[model samples]
Target chain A: MSFFDRFFGKEKKKSAGVAKDRLMIAIAADRENSRIPNLDQMRAEIISVLEKYISIDEIEISKERKGDMDMLEIEVVVKSTG
Target chain B: MGIVFAVISGKGGVGKTTTSANLAIGTAMEGKKTVVVDFDIGQRNLDMILGLENRVVYDITHIMDGEANLSQALIKDKKNENLYFLAASQTKDKSVLERDKVKHLIDDLKENFDYIFLDSPAGIEGGFEHTIHYADNVIVVVNPEVSSIRDADRVIGLVDAKSHKAKAGETVGKFLLINRIDPELIEKNEMIATDDILDILSVTLLGKVPEDKRVIDASNTGKPVILHKESEAGKAYRRISKRLCGEDVPFEDVENAPSKGIMGKIKGLFK
Candidate 1:
């Protein structure tokens, strides 16, 4: 383990002999709205927000409907340098 | 191996199921062995649209669960000799579609048929992902409306991000099928034009289906609209099928089409 990894307690664990860094964010639209927002614009906005924290390698957005509200679930895979 | 196409739309009621049924029947009419699998789960409607509801004994779940073999679950179309259908389970929940099971079933089907059409459920739920995961091609259906176009853009993104072809660093061919277009509405500037939709979705235009009442009538009567030779929608689907088969069929001039009147009716009868 590296000095930074041990001090910060950010331990990288391997599952099935492979390592991965995955981030997921769920954004729900306002229930009062009659329709969902434009997904393309939302995706761009979300990526801008995520860029401040991590270097994203790829992003995937999937739509979902729960009861009357619509949701956009975003998944981001961060770049690994090690 | 066969080409697997997923007829998907992010929004519901935009003619995804209707397009799937007609395309399956159209390709079968071209003498290719085709099978369309419904992935809608509990809200199964593809069989109803194909007029094969009464013929469905075993469904996709039964085959995936090993309770029935492929031959036992496959329902040959009553009208088209080369066409077959595998209905979605009405009793099982959408979660029953595990990734491995879906991949196995689709792989097996690809070995036996020339084309496999997966009728994806509306929205980007589990049912939709399961259908698109194994697709080699994708047909995104949309009506000429703002909401429908936006949702279709979302689906186009998913096809790139979620499909096995996409994950393998291979491109899954994507096409846009615009359905229920009304010429009068277009002239009145009430509906979005085909060019605008194509630009927004940024996919090749496969075909457009006109708003023909015969579509609904065919659905109600348990017949695919493609069987109605005189209907404009039927002709459009036939053109789409030929286009899918690598033919260069030209798009119909929707704006120049004869108005629906006695003269048009007479012309249609002759056609």
Candidate 2:
């Protein structure tokens, strides 16, 4: 944080580091939706149906290709009601 | 088949045209028959960058429309016998390029040249897909900024999903070329590091060019920076061109890359 440290190039954190972290999160999110059209709409529909019976914590939709087949995998984490 | 390398970036002004010109010239200097095609259309700058603007008799559209033959449209570089150029039509927009026509042009060029460099325009729309459609390899140029990196990732994804190779259940070669790397900015925590970009993109590191002022000067003179032996960016481009030819050229540690010429040595003494 001091001028001495900056001059010696011993700063613990850099904006570039922060940028890398931010891009990782942003690009991953973008890639997830890029594969499927109307991904958010699809998620909303699924949530509306699921909310009728159960509480959902988080929903993750990922797509992967194996050979000539496309596999769309969904992971739904349920909210615990202890 | 000849290798088609597309110098593409979804964001504009990240040095795609500069890289295309330099790499094409560099490979030609290495004695490989090279042709650089301007696919920018309506905003063509490759001819100006190569200093061959006055000599363009016909362009890519002329060849495709049967108005001119390939030899008539193709302009051989006056300085380099192995290098040639194809100008993009200034009057036509990106929509003028169709898939089949682009394929025919590429196929014809493949029969003559060892390397074909496509200087792609900015944005992911219109003729952008055609540029990467038949690309054997793509050099994704990024400027170490958030918007540039984000747009480049989008283009990378498109290359995977849209390219002819990708459509045929094959993968097109993807390489990362991080441009305008300012070490002083990195030291001041202002710019992204080369390794950080490589880690984020998860692509092979083709080369990293240090930010240089001479690049603009080279552009102004219609000479690619690669021809300047004293320029750091030029040296980096030459190294990248060699790597494209399957040569094992080691990358320079751009953060600590030594400055060339006398003034650089004096500046180093202070550091």
Candidate 3:
């Protein structure tokens, strides 16, 4: 406001928006494509492993994704005790 | 754990109400008791979304004004037994709610429900301040367009300023929900992708809901798409609900994903 007022008769500040497409894209990938395997995948893997025996109740497992040190984990309750 | 989330957008019709309505239903479908309260006083469509339009005899405004108790205003869901609705007032008056009264009402609801979802009024007006003042968490909905993202940023700032946690020098647990994303448009490099939106907001990516016809149909019937069991948006909302419950949900690669906008878009348009 000071410089504009002195030089150009009170010209207002017009903010030229910084295009954030590049930054937003990376953040979205990190979030949506979280490399850390999630719980749903873990549940599917657990079910496949338990296929020989029986269904199980909420299995608790946690794992971290490799990239950007992100992590994804889930807990699922299966009906059977097997 | 009882979670309180207020869904807000700087602008209206970007699905704040839709997301609030469906997110609550999705959470209930996951076996959590959930309720969505309308704070968008004059324009109340959440009841219509939950198909409780014909059932509401009271609203949060009533509780705020001491005209009704919270229990009396809590409407049972027509579909999900665990879901509930608190309709907004049809009157344009925003003076009915006092800040402390709204907070007290929310604290009381927390004692009974696992989650309380508030559908905020469009933009950061007077009502927007009250909507975010007591939020334990906030989900800012954006449509992947410039105007929407710009408004989302403004609301995110307001959220940081007014949140109870923020007042104690902590920021609200802010997340971004991008709705009506079209994979085909992203493949054509015409629309902003998940990454693009995330980069701008610098927030935790909740989920990206693809544009689908089922969404319109679900709203028409006052039933959430998550109840459908097979629709794409329903699947996304279910995942979003689960993620909100602190479940580990995997991300499915959208058909038009791997969208790199800046480097590519700049080159294509200029070169």
Among all candidates shown, the one with the greatest TM-score: 2
Model 3: reference contacts kept, as a fraction: 0.10
Candidate 2 chain B, poorest ten consecutive residues by summed lDDT: B257-266
Candidate 2 C-alpha lDDT tens digits along B1-271:
7889888997999999999999999999999999999998998899999999999999988877789999989999999999999999888877678789899999999999999999998988766788889999899999989999999998998887678887798879999999999877876567988878878888898999899999999989998899999999999999988988889999966777353557556545665
Task: Report how far residue B30 has shifted in candidate 2, in Å.
Answer: 0.7
The candidates' DockQ values read 0.02, 0.29, 0.05
Worst 10 residues of 3 chain B by lDDT: B262-271
- Residue B6, model 1: lDDT of 95
Q: State the TM-score for model 2.
A: 0.80
Candidate 1 pairs with clashing backbones: none
User: lDDT by residue for model 1 over B1-271, one digit each (tens)?
Assistant: 8999999997999998999998998888998899999999999999899888999999999987899999999999877899999999988899788899899999999999998999999999988998889899999998887667767766776686688788799989999999999988765345667776775567999998999999889999988788888999999999999999878999866654455667546544543
TM-score of chain A of each: 0.46, 0.57, 0.32
Ranked candidates (TM-score, high to low): 2, 1, 3
Candidate achieving higher lDDT, 1 or 2: 2
For A1-82, candidate 3 gives per-residue lDDT tens digits of: 4442435473543221223544354444544543344545766787788756766665755555576785546565668543
lDDT of 2 at B131: 83
Which of the two, 1 or 2, has more TM-score? 2
